[model samples]
Target: MPTTPAQPPVFTQKKLPLLRTEELMLNMGPQHPSTHGVLKVVLELEGERIMKATPVMGFLHRGVEKLAEDGTYHQFIPHTDRLDYVCAMYNNFAYVRAVEKLLDLKVPERSEYLRTIVAEVQRIIGHLFWLGTQALDIGAMTVFFYTFREREFLLDWFDQLCGARLTTSWYRIGGVERDVSQDLIGQLRYFMKEFPPKIDEYNVLLEKNRIWIARTKGIAIISAEDALSFGLSGPTLRGSGVEYDLRKAEPYGAYDQVEWSVPIGVNGDTYDRYWIRIEELKESSKIITQCLDKLPEGPIMADVPQIVAPTKDRVFTNLESMIMQFKFFSVGFPMPKGEIYCGTEAHKGELGFYIVSNGEGKPYRLKIRAPSFIHMGAFDHMSRGYMIADVVTIFGTYDIVMGECDR
Candidate 1:
């Protein structure tokens, strides 16, 4: 009976296994709206936070470099238009400047000033396009319309300057395709006068908007060292406070003759890049104005008979000039057996061309240092730890165009 006495029940707690989670893989583009082009990004995400990003390029690859090898130097100017098609003039300018360096050609003084003016106009157009599209991406709709409104004017001016608006092959190897008429100059001067306030209007819409500030500030930050290491140029590099601009550093065109300052940012974030571009719009306007006021009177094309095309009047009137034109376009000019790399300050970044010549018309080897492609190299580095939503902003911040990226 004592042994059978009831004993208190004993209790034990059971341990549960820890929950295991798997990361997610997301294909953001090649079709998605925000990729900026036929760009595909493989994002490894953990609950809406991006862990890694891999850019899948070549969707728009047209083997542009190979094409450069197949054609004459003069024939390739239009091809450069297809790369960064949004800002074709800069591409043309960069490519021609590279070819000129290889040929050791000297552009006329008037041609230099003209090239600078048109280039700055192209710069403003580029910045406007960037601002509009970028603001639209960030949920600010009004800014888009405003920026594009001004952009339309410049594009129309482009049409007047060169028959084409988007893919204008207005740049020549030693100079420009044609001189800027007085009427175009007058219109551009008017645009310069009106463009500053319009930039302010864009700022008014997003500069103080709480949502835009929250979205852009403290996002996608890169230091000056990293920027340089990554070979970032233009506003992207300047946003990191690096004051290296080919226009000023190398003094190409009339950049040295102009009195304008490069904008530097204290914090290398999306906001800083945006701010830098905004300031650049103003500086571009100032540059255009000065270049116009001091526009010299001379021939637009270099006097290199072999490389430069003869004037239309001469081509029509003189039998020898007609034959020369035909030969220049057909067989192309002979280049010395050498290699050269020339970097130009394009809208997106440093648009460089490294060409190897074999005493032939076509390039033996051609390489393009496209900013969109180079900037993509740093995408995974910059996008780590940011939210998935921030990817679009990062893309716009780079002002990426896949036309050049995949090429």
Candidate 2:
């Protein structure tokens, strides 16, 4: 029995199979096309799923806030154009509104209606740009072409209004740069009639698409509480079902006179955000139409000779008017020795300007609450657990323009 006891089988480490595991590191861009601009994202991936995302900004930073300190109130108007270059008129509107608020200036009633109509037109152009780019990012080539076609019409209209399409520095502190011509009004009226059908075409192309639905329906969701915590606004905030629109909550520029509803979404997904922008396009058109109908006959600029620039005719003929215009351009009108913050409902979100004055022509301190920058703070929260490919969808969902974000 003792001889029958055999040696036990020896265990060998080499015979057991080994499992390998590691997290992948990926740099999404400072140059990636889908990034929307010079944005770089450091991503930690676990089997193609995003575990963490850290956004690296400043690639496009030109110290815009610092630049604001070096210029007069009137001189700074053109600077805002580069912030959201896609919708430059809105940038102009938001900036001048802030400056006017600081001065306690009153804009003429006709100017308010003009501002509202132009702003809504800018909204439609912005939404079209967003829709086309977003659909293009999601592999829907047809929609990009279709949306841009409509967008070109609006851009042409902008050229007619301001003589510059992309960076139209047409808004003034006390009012707009000029009055809208009757022909321009006719063009807008025609666009209002023709654009609704084009929106329907976009819906037909993307709404029923299986790929688009699958990519966006449940992706990049954040609750209403979370969105508010992240300081989201405009369509991004409304996409989470929050009924906070500055146009309605705090009326300015004929918005109180017009009637239109804010579009809200149930689920805070990318698709819901897309839907919100589409609905906003319709609402913006309605706002513009109502504004035109109620457009008044009065002065476009305020009659504050001390603050506003003189008319071209006055500057040409009157020596005092010429001197005032020269002084206004060289040294800006003095602001009160205080600080003020003003926010406007831009297409992307609430574009805000906070200024500090020392009774000087130039702002002592200036800060911009850019929504692209704010929305980026929520990127990691929204992007986690999503597949790698969904990152582009998330970027487009925010309608991000790094000109604003990096500034």
Candidate 3:
């Protein structure tokens, strides 16, 4: 036994240039399943903790604002449907209201109620989407199937409302395109009764499951002040205990006329946001039920003959009605030369539109203050001190849609 042959003394450098700890950069998505749409998030990480996060957008840009400038006010409704396709009715409702604000046009009471019904339906659809995807991101696949199934019924309701499902273009400048029928009302009544229980089932799966709580309980906490400073609205803002819902704060459509309350949260974490959206699902159901019960008995379209399209019978039988319909569709009604910004409580947040009119059929310049876009800006701010895994939770809880964000 050579008694551990002590070869030469090896100089084990005691302080080796302070182990250069280079930051690790990671991109979450531009084509990810969890991200619903094309969203590339650049994350700077040290081990599993995040330092800085930048959300890279424009992957779904269609020059929507510029497209608004080129198209007529009515023509842009379909474009808006493409913005937040998961909540196309809300998109249609928001843009139409924005254009109507420029014209100072009055929507009929019946039309307002109808708009509210569809808008709330869109809310349910949007939140169901958020819930399913968020749960899926956290490794709960059953929630997605359950939510999307209920959502499909809502889509069919939208189809009955506008003949198309996703981009229904149901809402028009002064009013909605079609009125809800007795059959549709019956369907909603059935859904309103049946859906609350399903939400409970979802809660059973996610509300306090060990894995869910472990992953989301303390992740991505946003303070009330920081939430407002970040321009967050809808569930994200309310989840921070702000009670700053546009539906309650600045009532639009039949929101002021109706009797429903906006839900608020206490923790402002992922779980709080999740709970807020779940409550919103109930609130939205209540709104739809009220709208259906209090459904007015009058015309759905506004009195603005220049803007609203004539009925098909009127268009086919009468010469003046035909010409007016043609003129309205071909050139569109001219609005006052002014600027107006109108906002609505969309599924994600306060989806708003600012229109600059040149006394023309089309807008001079149009700008969208999309909540998804604004919410994503706070990513870098909110995800600073959280772990890299928490960044995904933040994105899910924030509920961003790249179509709306990029546009």
Candidate 4:
């Protein structure tokens, strides 16, 4: 729909050929800060309004799926950590779930509960990251600093659980690698109680601020039907008044046992998406609180010694244990030859992993469905008729991260 004067008109005038219209084509990114990553939006503008916005991607392509084919089953967990680097835990859970389903393995009850707790905590942290960065994108710098301060505590907790902070490949195919201590649970409980006050602080900063409301109110509206048609899930779908959440619909990892509500927005506008995440943070915090209280006592890993590592004492003392460990390390468990898709509600939207295994340790094919990619596809539809300044607000409100978009 974009027309530029530099190019010949679609329909030429016979007598008044001298007449012309002025429209400009602009490149916004591939290297701009507001994009949230290396995303390039080619905008054809008619003065201050965007006529068409075509998003160009692939700047951050790491060939993750290709890399998966070459790595061992255990080795590939770290690679998933790199995809949605902000919320690697969810990525880890999604991928492992797909692989586990293919293997038809059931994790221990305690491990499932722990996985739920860690994942929900990470979900809260991921939303906090989005809240802060999106606020900063729209020119509220104080919220960024405030949110990061809280994130630091969560990262510290992650470090305490696993040695690694960012890429905690703590999730194994059948279960978690190890158990969390009571002290860590206590720290998490303290965090859950304190986090709501921090969320309140964020709300005070911008929730009712006149400028924030004006910037967001009716910008970048996605209709419920269109959102559903586009396969929009997670907060994006919820923002459009759909109450479908993967945790509730396809209850994996003890999510069925916990009680939580899927928050929806009536308008599906930029403001609604923002509010959906804000409300989700509250809900995720509550889930974490319930999980912490219900933390059970049992073996963290399922007793599938062929798939999981043996006890440290057994491995150190017995020759049979050494051989089993060697077999587990060298020849990975033969997974069922089938394909399965597992999706979870990531910070953005539906993050899904489609995995095909061929009775080998490595997967035959792995494909990731990144929510940012689909959401970004609707940019032109969302941004048309909005002012150039409102374009920034719309992009920030959608919270599209190029890491997943380009993946």
Candidate 5:
């Protein structure tokens, strides 16, 4: 709990008793360090207590949903990368899986296993970022260095798997761009084997620290009902004890093949949300290692060559293959003129794409159910009655990225 700052006595007439102090309107950031991205929270405060918090958005919006209408389905892969820029793998998986569902395509078992591997890898990677920065927000600075250091290792593995580090359009409409090299698999296997001790180190650093507990134990508590009613998911929902992980509740990819536990919180406080992410890091490692062990030997790309990319020899030699190479990029394939909703459990929450197709090369309507956007909706409700300074902790725990929120 933050101590309220003492206010000077205000005399209206002849040294009379103090009247009500004027409420202060404080804007936290478009540049504040504690913000996840370019987000500004307009807070109405009386002394140190926040009466209202309005999150102003649209700063990073590049009209991604609108832009999707102008391009072919294959052309929109790069757009999903910018939504949750940190965990682009899952975004790629989510969008591609939605298209796959529409196409009624069965991805190869090998591709499913590999997708699950990278998805879990991104889960660990994303939460590691959240753990480090969220702890740093509450004054645990060392965690930032430790977490980002491991993040670099993961990024190197991603770089090897795909060329790009951050905004990787690695996953294709049917499958990935290429097969996972054995070298990359070996690197990931090594990481899965050795990552547990690192998580233990993060726990030892701040799990029981007095200052961390005082700052986060009960700060920004949201009840289960409110969390659900406000459309929260991911750790934010699980923190409130809702067992609603899309992977577990609705299995996709190779999630049904793997065995894991979803960590839940009893208190639904900042600390529980923090601890859940740490536990998820361990669970993610387990899933990745399991996928590595069960990885199948088969084609990485699907059999649908009209939508899937063909071999270079085929593209160079065959006239039909040449036209497919052109049409796949210039104009995409058509669907059955129906609406479908598919989502995957991305790093933030239930990242869904609702696509209404008019049997055209492009979608008639496309909307992204970005968890960052949904979580920000409850900002004012949660921040009410908390000390103004605790707003930093609340914001950190939700892990809002303005790119995703504003998109």
Candidate 6:
């Protein structure tokens, strides 16, 4: 009774609310499992929903661009291989394309055909890597092994062409370093025939699996409008139902002659994007088949002897060939003024390079527009109200590699 009387007196004395407002900031990464790379996502959580998210990058920064500023034009080729390490050929192609544009150099017809074959093969490998890892992220185990097995075959082909498996500095400004062997062509033809069935195997494993559908079908959906606005490209953009591809819209590297379909998704969801990439693998195989069938017979390199190094036999036997090699190695060819941005539908998306030349051997300025960086910007918007588990699925769908993002 005494306690009840005291409580009433306290209410008369003035009572205050027990609750207060505060913003809860949570650090999801820099070390978390779901970030995929050295990505740190700072999230603001209000109960089960995320109010805001901030991505902190540069943890994998290697000063690669600045390093290029110091090295010679030819010396920087290996460095470009590291930029988008997954698909080193794409990075090599992009940089050399910019340099070639600067020089106004024409690649031999045979070389152009060869480049197409290699790039499309690389696209297959890159997409396969993405599919395997993405499926694993969503808890599909056997699909990972199947995807990697196919990827290993491509890497073996790469090893056969270039001494190294990855980081092939095979492309030069004027043309390729060497010609493609008949053996390589035979192997590629074999891969083209064998790859489609493997893709079907992966589809059977996870494409319609109940668990996969529940996890990815409607989760982290992005409409086509939002995708284009957010600068999404490659499978990410196509998955959202946009039928735009650099290869189809603005064909490069013998793409104009090759016939293939550009796959589109009905809804901009994870599943659609998955389907888009799977379809792209088929289309890329078609392009490879056409290339092997029509590979021209001629010099793999241009007849510009001064620009390209002479063969080992010529280097030893001919004095003139030796002297030309010395000049080309010591003083690189001069590039023209003005800038050009050449883009290709890379494994990630629209990988473009804007190169400026002040009539110098080295680039005045080289700016790379990586697609993963653009796709990452949409993370906060896509994941605002989703559960913590949805983070992995959404991130996997974007297929961000730190090498490309930091580059």
Error of 1 at 256 (Å): 0.6
- lDDT for 346 in candidate 5 is 87
lDDT score, candidate 5, position 330: 83
TM-score of 6: 0.91
Candidate 6, poorest ten consecutive residues by summed lDDT: 1-10
lDDT of 6 by residue, 1-407 (tens): 00111010111212247756466888877886555568988878765556787888988888877776655577778988887888998888877777776667788888889999999999999989888988888788888899999999999899889876788888887788778788989988998998899889998998679998888776677778888999999989887768889988987788888788998887677777888888889999999999889888887777766456678898799998888777656665566788888887897899888877777666677778888788889988787777667778888898888888888
**What is candidate 1's lDDT per residue for 298-365, written digit by digit as tens?**
88888889999888999999999999999999889999999999999998999999999999988999
Q: After superposition, how far is residue 25 of candidate 2 from its true place, in Å?
A: 0.8
Over the stretch 1-407, how does candidate 2's per-residue lDDT look in tens digits? 01112122222233235656579999999998877789999999877888899999999999999999999988888899999999999999999999899999999999999999999999999999999999999899999899898889989999999999999999998999989999999999999999888899999998879999999887888889999999998888888889999999989999999889988887888878899898999999899999999999999999898889888999999999999998999898878999999999999999999999999999999999999999999999989888899999999998999999999
| Ranking 4 against 5 by lDDT, winner | 5
Q: Candidate 6, after superposition: displacement of residue 219 in Å?
A: 2.3
Question: Which regions of candidate 1 fall more than 4 Å away from where they truly are?
Answer: 1-18
Worst 10 residues of 1 by lDDT: 1-10
Which ranking of candidates, highest lDDT first? Answer: 2, 1, 5, 3, 4, 6
Q: Give the local distance difference test score of model 4.
A: 0.82
Model 6 lDDT, residue 277, Cα? 85
By lDDT, is 1 or 2 better?
A: 2
Model 5 lDDT, full chain set:
0.86
> How close is every model to the real structure, measured as TM-score?
0.94, 0.95, 0.93, 0.92, 0.95, 0.91
Q: How accurate is candidate 1 locally (lDDT)?
A: 0.88
Candidate 6: C-alpha lDDT: 0.81
**lDDT score, candidate 3, position 108:** 89
